[model samples]
Target: MGQDVYEELEREIALFLRRARAISKDFARAVHPELEADAYGLLIRIADDGGARGTDLADYYGIGKPTVSRQVRLLEELGLVERRPDPSDARAAFFCLTSEGEQRMERMRTARRERFQQMLREWDSGDAEQLARLLARLNVLFKTPLVDGP
Candidate 1:
């Protein structure tokens, strides 16, 4: 791509990130009045993973142990997360969502999906599918190192 194309892509990506941050804060507030915006990802991760160790969460998110621990503590206080002892390891505990957390997360996810569907209602089905495919591809590219780019 040309320098102009790269610059445009960077601008678009920056805008997307800003919008996403705003949405995340709104979504977190919708989940619970007291939930922090930054803790939203932790909630989603625990919900999706079924359960996760504190160390695993820290590692996966590239966050420090103290940060994860503090977030976990806040979630626990909010009654959104709970700890269960690892079946095979007496010293290890796994964090999972409470019933309320699960229900709230599911509802929020459903609402977000419906909103997306409505937003794309004007587009052809094929176009919407292609957009989803391209977004997924872009996310995968971000996760992997660039092999032939500056």
Candidate 2:
């Protein structure tokens, strides 16, 4: 509520976003050769949404439709995702992970979890639980506004 609190939150949030992006980029580079941040994020969104059209993905990611279209084309060329005609809407296409993509994602998620588990080796369960609770509360406190769909 205080000005000081707001400034501190802004600084902390910026640092957190930077460091988190670096870590994700590192992990992504290991899994995907020369993976762009936007492309990697699109994969995550497709995984989250079950399946989504390029227009929907652009809106969800707050990016331009042309950019989403380009990324989807690259992803398709790389065999990472498949674009199929939308069953409900014949004129639209939706993206879904390919088998190789799902396999790769599973491996990346497993490796990340293993790394976290190793780091928490000496941490008490109660401490871990407390940290999770606090982070969840913080996430709720700073939730971003959603950009309207395209």
Candidate 3:
């Protein structure tokens, strides 16, 4: 890619990240008045993955154990999450969303999906599908580690 193209891509990604952060904060606040903005992603991950351990979440997000533990504790205090003993490991526990959490997450997801549909209503269906596919591919690229360059 040309220098100009690379610069444009960087700019767009930066703007997207800003907007995403705002949206995530809003969504978390809507879910629970006391929900912390940074904890919103953790809630989503737990909901989507069914359940996960604090260590697992920390590893997945490339964050520190204390950070994940603090968020998980907050979620527990909010009554949005509960811990269940790991069937395979007596000493380990898995954190899962409560019914309230599931409902809140579903509502948030539905609202976001509707907003996305409205935003793309004027576009051709194929174009929207293409954008989704490309974004998914981009996410995959982010998840993959880069090899050392020569």
Candidate 4:
């Protein structure tokens, strides 16, 4: 790639982080009348993988295990997630979505899909799909710069 291409990529990555953080904050602020970001995240994880452990949630969210443990405790109190003894490791715990959590996750998915579709309306369908696939493929290899977002 040309120097300009690399420079542009860096600029876009920075701008994307800026915009994504703002959007996530706004999203959290707007929809938090029902659930906060951590709760919503746990629900999504459960919906994605059928269940997760506090450690898995911490790893996935890039947060500390103690943070995830606190969130899981709150979620359990809300009756959105239930913990069971891990069959593979009796001392450990696993969490799954309750029926209420599933319903909330479906609503979250619908809202997210609609918002993204609206934002991506100018893109060709094939190109959008390719971009999404590439982004997913790149996700593990790319880490956000520490200074980018709050």
Candidate No. with top lDDT: 3
Quickly count the clashes in candidate 2.
0
Which of the predicted structures, 1 or 3, would earn the higher TM-score when compared with the native?
3
lDDT of 1 at 37: 80
Off by over 4 Å in 3: 144-150
What total of clashing residue pairs does each candidate reach? 0, 0, 0, 0
Write the residue-wise lDDT of candidate 1 on 28-141 in tens digits: 998999988878889889999898898889977768889998998888999899998976686988899999889999999998789788989999999999988999899877
Q: What tens-digit string does per-residue lDDT give for candidate 3 at 47-107? A: 9999998888998887899999899999999999999997678698799999999999999
Q: Scored by Cα lDDT, where does model 2 land?
A: 0.82
Candidate 2 local lDDT, 35-132, one digit each (tens): 76668788877876777898888877668999999888877777778989997897999899999888877787789889878989999989989988
Cα displacement (angstroms), candidate 2, residue 55, comes to 1.7
Clashes of 4: 0
Instruction: Give the per-residue Cα lDDT of candidate 3 at 35.
Output: 96
Error of 3 at 118 (Å): 1.6
**Prediction 4 TM-score vs. true:** 0.78
Q: Which regions of candidate 1 are displaced past 4 Å?
A: 144-150
